[model samples]
Target: MNKTLQTDLLEIESLLELVKKQGIEYLNKIDERKTSANVHKAELINLDSKGLGARNTLQLFNETFEPTIVSSSGPRFWGYVIGGSTPASIMGDWLATIYDQNPQAINGEGDISANIELETIQLILDLFNLPKSFVGGFVTGATMSNFTCLAVARQWFGKNYGKDFAKEGITEKINVLTATPHSSALKSLALLGIGSNNIIKVNTIEGNREAISIDDLESKIKTLNGQPFILISSAGTVNTVDFDNFNAIKKLKKKYNFWWHTDAAFGGFAACSDTYNHFVKDWGHSDSITIDCHKWLNVPYESAVFLIKEEHSSLQVESFQNSNAPYLGNPMENFNYLNFLPENSRRLKALPAWFSLRAYGKEGYKNIVENAIDLAKYFGSKIKESENFKLLAPVRLNNIVFNISNNRNKENIDSFLTQLNKTGKVFMTPTLYNDQKGIRVSFVNWRTTKNDIELVFKEMNRIINIIE
Candidate 1:
């Protein structure tokens, strides 16, 4: 090996050891008052100041950096549908970094690593019961996944007449129909050529189930005439964790001629469980669906998969895609990475998922998902039993949205949320449902157990009693 390369590798090893020690040390003492929350609400320091070796800088990072992040990987972290990755996934991530494979096309990582991603895509398709011929791409997160799916949907619908709407841009108006609790990623669709103002909000909360009915959806679709309409349904909504009436939406798509897409970012994995499969019964009929492996599958961060109905539908019609002549491709055209993804240079992001799924088969995944649902229901039962806590929305899936109410001190809601955060027993979030402030807990972590749920209930009762 080259002397300089050897030296660099040695330094990396040393740093890894040091960081591991510091990380464990920091995690052990995270409850200290000095340890602050670090979810975009934390301090922003310059890159140089944040780096190691500087006496005070190293001290601050070692003392604070990770400990303060309120990581979802933590045993009690119940915030924002985050998943705790398995050791196998972590090992695969390390290998991905060491190899530094850029799977843009077959030329980047050859057929080996790129084919692994294709396999991951196929696995996701089968897991979700999507069409066998559906195309897929690895993206940064559900935002990019939704963006990619909608981008393809726009091109597919608008370019049906060879109009090239992406390049020419949407000269005519278009509307994306969706219900409340739509994944925030819808904003990405608007940002990407599809006008944000054109979003048609459908009333999903007609009853206890929290799913939008076909009657409401069909009425909305009738309002839009000649304009291109794309119906976006949620497989797992953020607030309620309720799936849209996928079967009803599927039937509507046939009659309306709108491109049907499902944003199953968090709950898509519910399909892995036999019990929750009914939530996404007709999901296979969707033109496209977004699944985030990092969320439900307990993989590491920054790994989400977007699957489309047809392979050719995902290809960008822009210059970059057109520039690369398909015929003169590398030997790995059997499953070239770039043919599917919007990204030219891609990481081996699928390995974590590949490792996790293989380590634990479909049955293993099913158990964890079902356990999460059971935990949610357990907590919901606690809320229903409590005279103080009002179940905000009906317990649908793994997400339980409810508010703690007393004699009628409404302002205490924020105080209650802060108390929960301060105690660090379980991390939850605040949301407005039916114009009322509420606490929402997402049982997305595989580490979560009956004990964890009991602890959360205990802590919540303690806080509610304190306020009372």
Candidate 2:
């Protein structure tokens, strides 16, 4: 080994201690950290023949790059429905890195990481009040989760016509119906060769709602003329947190033949509360569902799962199986995650979620979900009462979508959000809703409280005065 490598091995315990101390300090002071970073270009350093040891490299990194790190994982980061890591989740994440296990096969080659992954999936299903009839696996994020489910849906759509789209290429255009799909789902369609432009956009509810119109969806299906199609529905829309009527969609399943897929993502957490459970009622009837652990589950990034009905297990394997890789064993006989999901060699991403669920059981999650919803309502009410802001939509679930009441110019709302973010106290995302420029404040972080909302609201008023 190189001298530097030998030194690092000898000092591994001390190096880890230093890292743990830094991590603890960062976590302890996260709330005080800037919500947004003042990013600037850093000078590039050329590599030398002689290497710097890990400790020196750590110091160099702290001096050069650590200053601009933002607190997106901290409370008051009400943007894009992001969630912070729980203490238990952080522990599991550290172990996952240290173990360096690739969760692939459950009963093959003495690898049990995939079994742990399966157990984690079961825990998630129980958390969501879902049935065991659905088989699930962890993926990178909501984007990849959406991709995996939709890939299976695509295979099912093809199988309906007695065609195998996976073995052979997509031989024909597939009919996909949806309303207000998350952009990630559309990107998945593009990746799967389903052609995002080819989707039939169903109209949302008639007034002030993003939920799909059941009548319009039925009309679109009629155009298919009894052909098999895929209906990509939403459990909770990102902007307004609007939920499609899963009950109505479930009713339609009796009369129509289509693959039902709901991208629940964060909104699925509503099931944790009695008050908000109605938003996702009947969602379990869907053929597939995507939920993000990194969102309301409060796990770290790069963790999400896709739950597809067990009846479609064959199709899922067919959609993602690697047929020619002999070493992976029989795709059907051995039952590996690599055969069921998009990734072939993924880390034990399920560990954090497993740790989270085990640490805080059903009741604990109920508190987290309820608290988030209540804070969102509190913030939304503040926005409604303020003369400076107009609620663009109802304070549905854990998001508040609104517009600046007085500022008519489109650029002004964007400027207001930018300034508010510059304050480093809070961060929000801007959007265009129904042709009107709007801002969205999502409250999914478990640490966020009423006080945080009040702080952000006061900051917003200050910025409003400056912009006006």
Whole-model lDDT values for every prediction: 0.73, 0.89
| Residue range 1-468, candidate 1, lDDT tens digits | 755455556677666777667656654653332312645456765675323443344567657654556555755677778887776777777778778877655343444576677787777776666677776767889888888878777776666556767667766566778775354555767667676666888876566655676677778878876455788888877888888887777677667777888888888877887777888889888888888888888888899988777644433433125344442443224555554556777788988888887788788788888988898899899888987787878888888888865655768889988887777566888887778898888887777778877877888778877975
Instruction: Return the TM-score for candidate 1, rounded to 2 decimals.
Output: 0.87
* Candidate 1 weakest lDDT stretch, 10 residues: 314-323
Q: TM-score of model 2 relative to the true fold?
A: 0.97
Q: Give me the runs in candidate 2 sitting further than 4 Å from their true place.
A: 42-44, 326-333, 407-411
Candidate 1's clash total is: 0
Q: For model 1, what is the C-alpha lDDT against the true structure? A: 0.73
The TM-score values for the models, in the order shown, are 0.87, 0.97
lDDT of 2 by residue, 134-251 (tens): 9999989999999999999989988887999988979988999999999999999999999878799999998899989999999999988899899999989988888999999999
Steric collisions counted per model: 0, 0
Q: List the residue pairs that clash in candidate 1.
A: none
lDDT of 2 at 364: 89
The candidate scoring highest on lDDT is 2
